[model samples]
Target chain A: MSAHLTEIIVFSVLFLLVSGMGFVAAKWRAPTDMAHLDEWGLGGRSFGGWITWFLVGGDLYTAYTFVAVPALIFGAGAAGFFAVPYTVVIYPLFFLILVRLWSVSHRHGFVTPADFVRTRYDSPTLALLIAITGIVATMPYIALQLIGIEAVLKTMGVTGDSAIARHLPIIIAFAILAAYTYQSGLRAPALIAFVKDTLIYIVIIVAVIYLPYKLGGWGAIFEAADKKFQASPAPGDGIILNANNQVQYFTLALGSALALFLYPHSITGVLASRNRDVIKRNMSALPAYSFLLGLIALLGYMAIAAGVKPLPGAKPGSVDSNTVVPLLFDLHFPPWFAGVAFAAIGIGALVPAAIMSIAAANLFTRNIYKEYLRKDATPAQEAGVAKITSLVVKIGAVAFIVFLDPQFSIDLQLIGGVIILQTGPSVILGLYGRWLHRGALIAGWAAGMGLAFWMLWQIPNAATGRKHFGGSAFALSEFGFDTPKTIYVGFVAVLVNLAVAVLVTFLLRALKTPEGVDGTAKDDYFADEGDPRIARRLPGTVEKVSST
Target chain B: MAEPESPHADTKPRTDSSPWNWLLLVPIVVPLLTPLFNHDEPRLAGFPLFYWLQFAFILLGVVTTTLVYRMTRSRGRS
Candidate 1:
């Protein structure tokens, strides 16, 4: 059979497997009622530590991550490794931030960070901005996952000469995702994550073990990568970092660390855990994926060693770098093994896309819909809103992939990181103290967002021959900072955000402007698993398990 | 001073040496340590040593997850 046929058959089987898992997920630990937001959106908020660990791990380490990180390393050289350290740092930082968030969220029954922002700062406007930012940030992320699926399709030779024809499979896949996600709510992805993560593990392990022997050894891979980098005109374009990219490196790593936990989906995973300890335990453990990521990053070097070239007729240096892992497998491994690796990437997309859509949907429902559209909406109504909103989010993400350049979608992902980073002061900082004036926090968010956009506008993609700044991250020098030092624009934007917030807070306090009342008690921040006041139990009004 | 309430009080009562209580640390620590032992090797089927380490970690991950589940159930019974 032709390679295209082989790929189609393989992808069809995998798609069935994922969709079957999604349908089956509603029955796995099946919550009795699907009408309530807690049940539909938060998986009833009773997942044990292990479940939450897998769920969050699967949620954060996505198909885009699986494809993009390596693809980046393949294309840009050492800079791609930035994702590794950033992921590593995220867990430790979250250990402190998440536990507090869990306690406070549990006390107030918040499903989204915007909900907490609303109550803590007593500002609907701030909450609204957060909700919009979350949706905007997440939309591109969901679109990026489609890029992973599209990469597979292209490798499989499932495309037309035109862009629309090339992306038809992605559109169909997302349509299915939208349907299932809407039906099952968060439970769909939470359950599917198990299958997705299991597949990814199987594929990565087999490839890592099998690929090295075929290509000679690690020394050879690094040598090839180094030779490639040295040959390139770009100063820093090879196997290791140079002086110019160091500031960009450190700032990107730190910026990403801050940005990772700030995503609404990340917070959703944390809140779904059974207690604070689950959050604590997952924080230290999730770094394992970072280690896995480090391994994945090395795939770039492996591609170089294997002498894997982009497909014929591909643009100069514009070959689908995302296909490197799959191409590596096809070039060296048995066909069956290639099938499994393809399945892993395909499933990886589903897990995070599901979570991103759910998180975005929750933001719209709790922060926007219930807050504005229907204040007296019943729990069932709220859940229905969330379900429909998830559908919209999935469809919107699909549209982004189908309509816009895939590279632009990646730019949006970086932009999403920048936008979400604005929430750090509101979510992360607010956890420690309420000293930040809500008004100032709003002002900071605007300033940071503006600067982030301006920085993003300056970055130009060299490969596509596009001139405008196109990716999610930016270098400090790009902003015309006179200092020779480089920084991630998100990092700089966040600093500006914090500075503006601090300045505004002091001004508000001096002027004796009314700070809104905090709905949560101070003791709530320290509440743990056994706190009687916040103990887990059936709500007083629930008359039956199947009420929905 | 009053003894702090047992954090696991909301669930089944805890017993001394309950495996579930300790299972918590496995996911937390295993991922953190796996990298220290990770080393580079030649590519097999286009994958490297660091890549294989991820697979090894995944195996370790599965074992840890199973152990945690079993411990939780056993502790609940005890």
Candidate 2:
């Protein structure tokens, strides 16, 4: 392999630096005890505004911003800019939803979303399902972050014909991530995120300013991208959305926005904030990152103008579009700066991957292991389980990359969005009040998840030659419509989920079926940091799951 | 441990359920209106109406949410 020795050196040094930070983070804000779920999994839940900003931004904006968005824009044209609107709309929803969740979570000492669900519905079965959904959805997302790192590595000329050679560096990177995360818990990512976001802001600001000026100008870049799209045969390819994909773009944007905070990682970030005011302020300010994402998406058009080609895929004759952004940087930027850019994307992947694994681990330990395996498990044992689970979760994500080899890493995330959206009826709706019966919520989740998977199974990615689970787009023709309009499967599935939930709720109420006891009262949702009515817990421990 | 009840607590002190919170809907609905900006005209600095308008939507979201937060934060725990 023709490795760029200079680029590799720079990338390795920065990566090692971040890994060191991850290890040292255990002492950053030393807790009295590290052997409890709240202290270990939620970073002591005392983050002020700036740390919350960096950590949440780092958690949400992710490698998806640096690697996946530009790659999609390069490959699919304007339809891919759905990421811009998706991020734009989330803050409004965040302001309305997250503050309430934070207050209630802090009030009751809930560590995961399923922890909230368990008390709200008073159904261990429903909470178990939510926990499983979060774990399953988060696994692919953690794996997608590896795709970001893999793309950068491939661009640095670290490749081999053998599978082990292709994945060895990624395995090494994640292993180090797992080690630090196991030691430091959420603090590891919270500390590293500051470094990650600063580097990203610098890299993106320079690329947007310098790259456009160097490669003619923005007009030439757009013109070149338009010209390429115009010559392509794909109906979805263009500078602007066509009639057929316009609905797809809107629904994809809206569906993805709805699904964003539903992921356990997003909730983990929100709950870790010190108070409701931090969440409220951050929700307004977080849209600043959306502006950065808009500029990042345009880098795809710049790639078109720069004529940056993707590197070869693991499979014969297949190209990995995930490599597009890294290849663009390698082509245009100076060697050292390009290495810095590569490090920015690689480190970007690590932040969310770390947060996501911790989130999933929390769900497993709280919802499953403690609930079923050992009902009286102490806080120390719970933290121990979560730490071990994080390692196992990272290993599972590594296996996803090494084995599955999906055509596009973004598709892995989209599939995750659909799976996680099924939990909305129980989790998000339950926040308002427990109007929907526990049985109805369970039925709705099953219906939504079933239809979402079935629809995904029918889509075939013509590029990858995969027969099923190809992509998230569901053709209207599948329902016998004689048109070319396609819609986001998650959007359609959630609608059915809500309808079934409402209809079944009416039926169950009419039949006089007894509902589970809601462990929270209305005032609990409004409880703040100093509220005495809230549950009092030991400094390091999570409160017991309130099973009525 | 129950704290002493204050005299003002009898009125169901719902300071957070304010009218200003509804203004947050503007940012959410305004961006979803794709026809408002999805076009080739009015390109700014090489960005199409589609591209530049999306950035404007981001600004719209920030301003609207900030206004809501500023108006609502003074009243209750939120």
Please name the candidate that would achieve the greatest TM-score relative to the true structure: 2
Q: CAPRI verdict on model 1?
A: incorrect
User: Model 2: per-residue lDDT, tens digit, B1-78?
Assistant: 111233123335443678988998888887777788779998998889999898898998988888888887766533
DockQ of 2: 0.47
TM-score of each: 0.86, 0.96
Candidate 1 displacement at residue A43 in angstroms: 0.5
Candidate 2: chain B TM-score equals 0.75
The lDDT values for all models are 0.74, 0.89
lDDT of 1: 0.74
lDDT of 2 by residue, A1-548 (tens): 34488899999999999999999999988887788888899998889999999999999999988988998899988988999999988999989977778877887789999988998888999999999999999999999999889999989988676889988999999999999999999999999999998998999999999988998999999999999999998878898988788778888898899898899999999999988889999988898899999889988999999998888887889998888899888988888999999999999999999999999999999999999999878788899999999999999999999999756889899999998999988988888878899999988999999999999999998878888888898899998999999999999999999999999999999999989777776776776776765445556334333221
Q: After superposition, how far is residue B48 of candidate 1 from its true place, in Å?
A: 13
Off by over 4 Å in 1: A312-317, A472-475, A478-485, A535-548, B1-78
DockQ by candidate, in order:
0.06, 0.47
Residue-level lDDT tens digits of model 1 in A355-404: 89989999999888988887767777788988988988888988787677
